[model samples]
Target: MVLPTRQNVEKVLEHFNRKDGVIVVKGKELRERDDTDVEVDFRQESSFYYLTGVAEPGFYVVIDVATKRIQLFAPPVNPDDVVWMGYPDSLETLQTKYDVDEALYTTDLDARLKEASAVYTIPHFNLTFKDEAIKSASTEDNDALYAAISEARIVKADWEIEVMRKANKISSDAHVKVMEAAKTGINEAELYAIFLNESNRNGAFFQSYMPIFGAGMNAATLHYNKNNATIENATDMILVDAGCEYNYYASDITRTFPVGGKFTEEAATIYSIVLDMQKACFAELKAGAKWEDIHTVALEVAAEGLIKTGIIVGEKQELLDKDVVAAFFPHGIGHMIGIDVHDVPKYCTSVERIDRPSYRYLRMRRTLAAGNVVTVEPGIYFCEFMIDPVVKAEETKKYINVDILNKYKSVGGVRIEDNLVVTEDGYVNLTTAPKEIAEIEALMAEASSKKRKLE
Candidate 1:
């Protein structure tokens, strides 16, 4: 990790090694809920962690471009602090631990900045330290630095890939646990708890995001997190979009499974379409592949599936051109995943987001490159909010099979999400949860047999 952090810093220096400027980045401080005694756990900012791999707060890094020296500034620990927060590492220990050229007390930061002609920081979402003494100092714009770092982070380092693989494994196993625990009578909250407990037991520090354990109609609402519904219909499906963070690297996966261990006819039909769409997208993932084109492929495949299933009637291309696919599959195909779930360098020199309906929400619009990890999640939802207005509109209602669509009004949605890393030849899927319909049914049936014996 130390070597990788050093390499990452060197990458940053490649673009900003000027004679007079110093690059400054601030780590996150411990934060508390507004006016409350409860304190949120401290996690170092992503950029700070990328450069220094230091997790503690009240720390900052200064990279001098002239000498190419890296200095780490940390807050001095007091005796009173030690009493409450345990023993603190000495300056020499931290210096050696982080492999920095020099480690000094943060109080000396102002004096150090005076030696440099300009101070530069990363763009938005950065912690900027303010000192009245440095008000007169010239501040360098950080656009170039931000773009450089973001580009560098687009393709992950070897160490990052390793951490992400582990995170995905933990998340994958957790999803399996939830699938086994799911049943017609279980509340969504109970399934959520099962996922959390499994992830924690498998060594996840925290969830990358709030778990989405939507049952029945709730599943149609993307990003649903209320998770309080009781799954009364044995035939309804459960969509669990959840993942955990391991060592600050994130893994995102979503699995939709039937509550009764076997998918109902309506649920199975939608699931097959979504699963096929995911496979089509996966086949197109490789180095230099255009992301927007991949999304277009997803739309074409989904539209074709909808047409085959009698939900929509039209030529595939015409349906896509008319934006009819957006009714069933509203969101983009997927997004990049790394320290941040939606990783940076979304648009680069060769690629930018397209303004079309499906491509607009696409998080990563750049061409694919080896070492880039992304999620291939394509869904087919039956949400009334997204479909009703379009169906009622006189212009777009002709393509919709209203009778067939009404039959699935209660079907909710089906999303098959998996994390994958782009390679020279193709992509390697990181998610290992059971996705095949037969596989899911068999796993749940085995769990039920064990439960019956226990009872």
Candidate 2:
């Protein structure tokens, strides 16, 4: 699986050379859940993985600036440990596998730091050796080191993009499988289980984040993950915002569909509008485009659609100027997606997040560039909490059509999200799940037909 090559380590070391410092990075360790004896499956920390690409716990990497040398310190295993956890690779095996200059036992890490003049390490809550290493040398916070890595990560290398493409393909296929199996009486948890099963069967070791399997009113909650509600086919819509990790890269996708295999009149109208809004945003994405501008375009498109459907009554431009669209689309349009789901933010040096209502929630505000991977998601929700309080306010009341809005208050929401990579001219969509209305209906119909034949 695509381990970071020597060239990747050299890139970070070059940044460290500017300050004449050495870098000390700690890998993640296996830990037990809260109070349980069971240990959670181990995953390498993202920053550490980006440099070393070693997945095992209890390891550290040191890159020396002056000498341009890299070394790995790994935990040594004894016969008893091997009896419990099976055979462990030798230091020579690790050095060859990870393509490092040398590998030594982690017990030597403390002594190794004594030779460094300046040291830098990324702050991590669970880091085992950060404090000790700092005390042993003239260490600093190293905000520059963090920024350097983050900036480098903004534009993915060809190999990184390839891994993300595979991740998106696996996630998209799993989403389709869940859509075909979804029905009226199934519990939200069952659908989540189906997604997990399919992802695991296809070789995804972990989900990028907790799956959002909301049905009906539950869909209105942005980060909902209870996944315990019953899906009412006659009235409810299923919104699954889930993705899987492949080779340390992440894919995030969201698809909203009718549980009854057909959208009701009101549901159809709202779904189509949300879909169009996403399309408008996609058209605006390209190298050199500001993320804020793309978001503003999405807001305009959604506002016009809401006005056409009688949900809001006002001039489209006036509604946008008043920031009234924030009530329906409360969150940012999307964010960068890669090693971390909400990948590194557009650092303050690039652009500070705007303070205005609709712009405040944006996660990335920098100009787009080629080789950058991002998710473009635009949605509209009838969230009672976010809408009702504003609706009660006298000054904001005139823009709403209360009668028409009430009809959809129970409709929950509609969101369509896809992963894409910026190209020289536009963007290439990595997600290939069927999104057209006819395509969704036909696939569900085929599944139903097969079920009937089996019975």
Candidate 3:
């Protein structure tokens, strides 16, 4: 269904807080492959999609902040292009399809811009036409508009939430597919193909981001997406971090499990600890809960788990204070998820990052509120690159038990992630992939049995 984007436009207008000027938004334009005529795949810019809900390229949205009128401008149809690319959507069709008040050709956009008291476009939006009425807005003005739009998106409308849920469902099922198909002797590339087939068969053509089909040591690399390794050990954990975008809304999910369908003793211990971290973070989630405080809950859980496992040798506070724990759980706990995976201001309260090594990548720094959708992804990685600096350091080396750390390093890394929509009381989980050890092992075993019977 076409999103009812007028309400989104209204929200942007309310946030812009100015009635005298027109807010201009540029949509994505069609492009071709470098040095070739082959057209590139088209994906609309998130902000433009939020405003117009028009996925086709070469579109523009002009919103009159005063009257709340939204007009969509479409690329003028060319008969020559139509001969190659079928008849384009007519102006009337564009109007009805996008549910815009007025639909005009690009010919009218310059005139509209020329007539505006001042044209305001969000950051990173380029305006090709020039007019005296287009007085240069200060950097702060553009940033303000960008921030205002981001604030509008921070709390999704009901329809937006539903779209995101649909995306999560597709992605969750895809993860299950990858899980059931994985086994020793299979290349990560094959499993990655399974994930793509699942998403495609379900009508989702694009993944929210690159899929990471990291096996064994590969999982320790946080941004690993090589997806090319072969699983030599059945018990080594494979981390699959992927999701698909549905109708512009996005879902981000991560799941890690053993290729053999049963986790090793060490694997289960680490996996359970990460799961506990997620649960603790969830308990702290709700309106008015501070983002960093929820993150702290994950860090605390990680510290306790590491100590229990004998990988670290210190009290939790001292370990956290000395940044020893950050080596294992280096990234931020989670971030806002929406049309764009890394949806911005990354914004909540205009607060800056804590800048400490532990809080360096905290994406959102504001207190949680109802209607906010976020991911609760807390992980523990054993990548030597991330850990050795601390081990080599004179101050932090005492906390890590090198012998014990090596014993579990083969487990590599484990990350558990889920999408959640915040409510007044708490959050509603949108991810449905089975994260429980028994559930995963059972499903994979069932799948393996079917394959054995077929063989």
User: Which number leads on lDDT?
Assistant: 3
Arrange candidates by lDDT, descending.
3, 1, 2
lDDT of 2 at 75: 84
lDDT of 1 by residue, 1-455 (tens): 35458778887777653556788888898888999967898888988888888988889899887777899999887788688789778888888898689999888888988777777787674444476544222334577778777877768888888899999999999999998988778999999999899989888968998889998889999999999999998788999999999988999999999998998888888899899999998999999998878888889889988998898988888888878889888888988889888777655655666787667788767778999999999999999988887788887888899999988767798999999999998998989999999999999999989988999
Clash pairs, model 1 backbone: none
- Count clashes in each candidate, considering only residues at least 3 apart in sequence or on different chains: 0, 0, 0
What would the TM-score be for candidate 3 when compared with the true structure?
0.98
- Scored by TM-score, the top model is 3
Model 2 score (lDDT): 0.84
Q: How well does model 3 score by local distance difference test?
A: 0.89
Scanning candidate 2 in windows of ten residues, the lowest lDDT window is: 131-140
> 312-357, model 2: which lDDT tens digit per residue?
9889988888878889998898999889998875445656778877
Write down the TM-score for model 2.
0.94
TM-scores of the models, in the order given: 0.95, 0.94, 0.98
| Per-model RMSD to reference | 2.1, 2.2, 1.3
Which pairs of residues collide in candidate 3? Answer: none
